[model samples]
Each structure stands twice: as C-alpha cells, then as structure tokens.
Target: MNQLELLKKFTIIVADTSEINSICKYKPQDATTNPSLILKAVELKENRKFLNKAVEYAKKNGGSKKNQLTNASDKILVDLGIEILKYIPGYISSEVDARLSFNTEECILKAKKIIQMYEEQGISRKRVLIKLAATWECIKAAEELKKDNIFCNLTLLFSFAQARACAESNVFLISPFVGRIYDWYVSKNLISTFSYNEDPGVTSVCKIYNFYKKHNYKTIIMGASFRNIQQILLLSGCDRLTISPVLLKELELNNTVFNRKLIPPTIFLEPPRPLTEDEFRWEHNQDEMAVQKLSEGIRNFGKDQLLLEQIISKLI
Candidate 1:
C-alpha cells in the first residue's frame, strides 16, 4: 500500500487545505482551515469567484461596499468552509482570530458568531469544529463554548501541559502540532534517527495520547503541523492527523507500510500524574522550545490576521 493508505490504516487522515478541488482529490475524512489557508485559496483564479461573490453580497447588505465586503469575506469564508464540508462525512475545523487568544470572553463571543453564521447557512454544530489557539485564555474560552455544546479543536498546542490542561477541561479535540516540534529540534541540532519510536514529534503526541487515554479523557487527539510523510506515518493510530496536501500527495504515491504505533490505553495504564496550574506554568516556562514556538506561532497567526483585516478593509 502507498503511505497514505498505510497512514489511513492507523489514523483518520485530514486534508489540511481550503482549496475545494484539492480536498476532493484526496478525500480526507476531515479537513481544517486557517486564515492563512483561506487567504491562500482566495488568491487562486478558480476560487476568486468566491471572493467576488462575497464582495457583491457585502455591497448589497451594508453601509458601504467596503463594510459589506468585509461581511462578505466572513460569509465567504463560512461558505467556503461549508462547501468543503460537503465532500466529507467527518468534521471541518474553522479557526477564530489568533489575535483574540488572550481574551477568553472575546474568543467565546467570536466562536458563537461563527457558529451562528454557519447555522444560518443550514450547517449544524456537529459538523463544525471551532479552532482556537491553546493559550490558557483560549482554553477557558473553549470550556465555556463547550458548555454551550459548541465543540472546539484546540490548535497551536506545543507542550504536555497544554494537552493535560485541555484534557482536564474536557475539550472536544486537541491538535498537538507535530511539524513545529520537528522544526524546533532541527533548529537546535537535535535530529537523530530512531527505531521508528524516537521521533521527537511522534514521541510528543504519544505522550499526550497516553496521558489522555490512561486518564480516560474524552477529548479527541488530532496531530497537526506536519513537515514530512514520516512524521505522519510515525503518528499512525493517533485519533486523527491533519496533513498538508503536498505531504498527503506524497503519501498517496509512495508505498510504505503503516502500523499502529500508538495505543494510548495500553501504553499509559498508570495513573496520570496530577498537575497544578503553578506547576504547569513552571514546566512550560522552562521548556524554551515550547515557549519560543508558541509565542512565534501566535505572532505569525496574529500578523496574518492583521494583514487579512487590512485586505478586507481596503476591499470594503
């Protein structure tokens, strides 16, 4: 079997793209979209119609065409998300503004707004997973959103503490980034071959997976941010994995045996060690890689979000 099929044997493969055509080609069980991905898609000739329609719709609905255009962009994003969802029976993840990571209240408010937008289009909460950064404030926001039956997919996760905190709060899903971990190790000159068991990213997810399974947390684990096919293959049997289209294509073309590398329950039968917020904060504070990357991820997402808003404003 090709690597994609091999990975499928062990995990639910998600196509990480906003391009409907690319998603249709891979037939990923689930799909994820970020502002960055959506921005990229809107720039495409084939997908430009979606943006155009958004502009026209906005012009008709509001104070100015510009204001209308912004609304249209938001509507178009939701429409594009719902359109992508039509191809899969599984869930589609749509992220909120990374800029609001520190404002739990704003995050909750925005999440509700997005859900309402989707519902207005006949999309149900079951099919839409609101994505948020794994900041403490975002986690608290998710807790409130979860109470409202709004499921969440916590993204930008980088450490065991973040995973543990999410599990404790009972989130719907957690996306522990994989490729970013590899990036850290590479930059620090820590890359080394393992006997299919010691890849840093693989080990990171395994740690989180075992913790959740052993403790019986219902929050699903979805590994995201992949750099290579090996990283995806190594994480087979994870609850779900979101992979880039380029890597997904590589997986589909190569013949590589995929195996169940992570069985959380069997692997983590011991009781989960308890963690206080103080301890969690301290642990994360000491992990330079996690601290640096989490900050960097938030900054990058925030910058892109700012740029997107600017683009929307100009068009409005």
Candidate 2:
C-alpha cells in the first residue's frame, strides 16, 4: 500500500480544502474549510454556481449590505460544505468567523446559524463540527453550544492551555495546527527544518496526546496544517489529520512504508487540568510562539473573510 493507504490505518484522513472535487479525489473521511479555503473555492469556475446562488440568496433575504455580505459569506461556506459532505462519509468542519473569535455570545449565535443552515439543507447537525478559534471566549461559547448538542472543532490551537481548555469544555475535536507551530519556531531561529522526531510541532502534538491519554480526556485530536509528508507520518495515529491536497497528493504518490507514531499512552491517574478562564489566558499568554501564531492566524482568516465578501460584492 502507498503511504496514504497505510496512513489511513492509523489516522482518519480529512481533506482540508474547500474544493469539493478534491474531496472526491482524496476520498478523505472528513473535510474542513476556513475563510482562506472558501475564498479560493469561490473563485473556482466549478464553484461559481454556489457563489451565484449565495448572491441570489442575499437578494431574497434582503438586509443591510453588511449583513447581506455576511449572510452570503456564511451561505457559500455551508454551500461548499454541503457539497463536500456528499463525498465524505464523516463530518464537515465549518468555521465560525475568526473576527468573532473573542466574542462568546456572537460565536454561540453564529454556530447555531451555521448548524441551522445545514439542517435546512436536509443535513444533520451531527454531521457538522462547527469550527471556532481557540480563544477563551470561543471555548466558552463551545461549552454552551455543546449543551444544545452542537459539537465543535476548536482550531488555531497552539498551547497546552488551549488543549486543556478544549478537553475540559468537552469539545468534539481540537485541531492543533502543526505546521504553523513549526513555522513560528523556524522563523525565530532561522532554521531550515527539524527531523520528524525532534520537530517542535510534532512534539507539541505528542505532548498533548500523552497528556490527554493519561487523563482519559475523550476529545479527539485532529492534527492540522502539516508542512510535509514526514509531519503527517509522525502524527500517524492522531484521531484525525486534516491534510491539504498538495500534501495528500504527495502521500498518494510516495510508496514508502511508515509506522504509526502516535498511540495513546496507558492511563496513569493524575490530577486533571481543567484550566480556569484566567489560567487559560495566563498559560497561553506565556507561550510567545502560541500567542503570535494565534493572533496571526485569526488576522489572516479574518482578512480572507473580507476578501470573500469582496468577491460576493462584485458578483452581486
């Protein structure tokens, strides 16, 4: 079996793209999309139909231009998500706006709206994992949404504090961005790269994995934002791995065999870390790389969201 085939034995392969066609090509178990991916999908010729439909949707559901654009943006993400769901048998992670990352109330309201859109399309809310940035407020938002049976995937995760908060909140899944973590370290030190065993991103995920396994936290760990096939290989037994198409194609082509690198450690009873709101902030604040990357990630996604609105503006 090729590496991709073998890797599936360990990790649930999730296609990390807004391109529905690629999801079919990869045959991933799940698919994830953010503003950046959705923006790219909006420009694709094949996905133009969804964009046009969203414009018509905005027209019919008339509101202020800002609200219209916001609604249309949400519409297209779900439209793409709805289409991608047809190919993958598992969940589709549709993100809450990064701009709303710090607003607990808004995050809860937005998540409900996204779930409602999927339900209206005859898709079950159970099939959607509402994605939110791993800000303290967003985590609290997820805690509330969970009571309503709306599961979430907390992304932009960087530090142990973020992971602990998600676990205590009982989030459905947490996507610790692997490659972005590695990138921050490399930029700081001006290094080319680290080997898979020593890679900072890989180590970060492993630390969380061991901690969760030791504590028996049931939240799923889906490693995301891989920079290379080796990073994918290193995280072989993650609950899931959200891989970009470029890296997915690379894994498909490489016939090299690999072994599962992440296995849940045996339970060793210890005090569970249910980080308080202040503790979460302080602990996360201390990690310079996490702080910077988390902020940078939210800004980039927020920018892409605006750019997506611009596309909607021109089309409408």
TM-score of each: 0.91, 0.97
| Residue-pair clashes, model 1 | 3
Candidate 1 Cα deviation (angstroms), residue 116: 0.2
What lDDT does each candidate get? 0.83, 0.91
Model 1 lDDT, residue 88, Cα: 89
In model 1, which runs have C-alpha deviations exceeding 4 angstroms?
57-73, 192-196, 266-276
Candidate 1 weakest lDDT stretch, 10 residues:
265-274
Could you report the Cα RMSD, in angstroms, for every candidate shown? Answer: 2.5, 1.3
Candidate 2 segments whose C-alpha is farther than 4 A from its true place: 190-193
Show how many residue pairs clash in every candidate, following the order shown: 3, 0
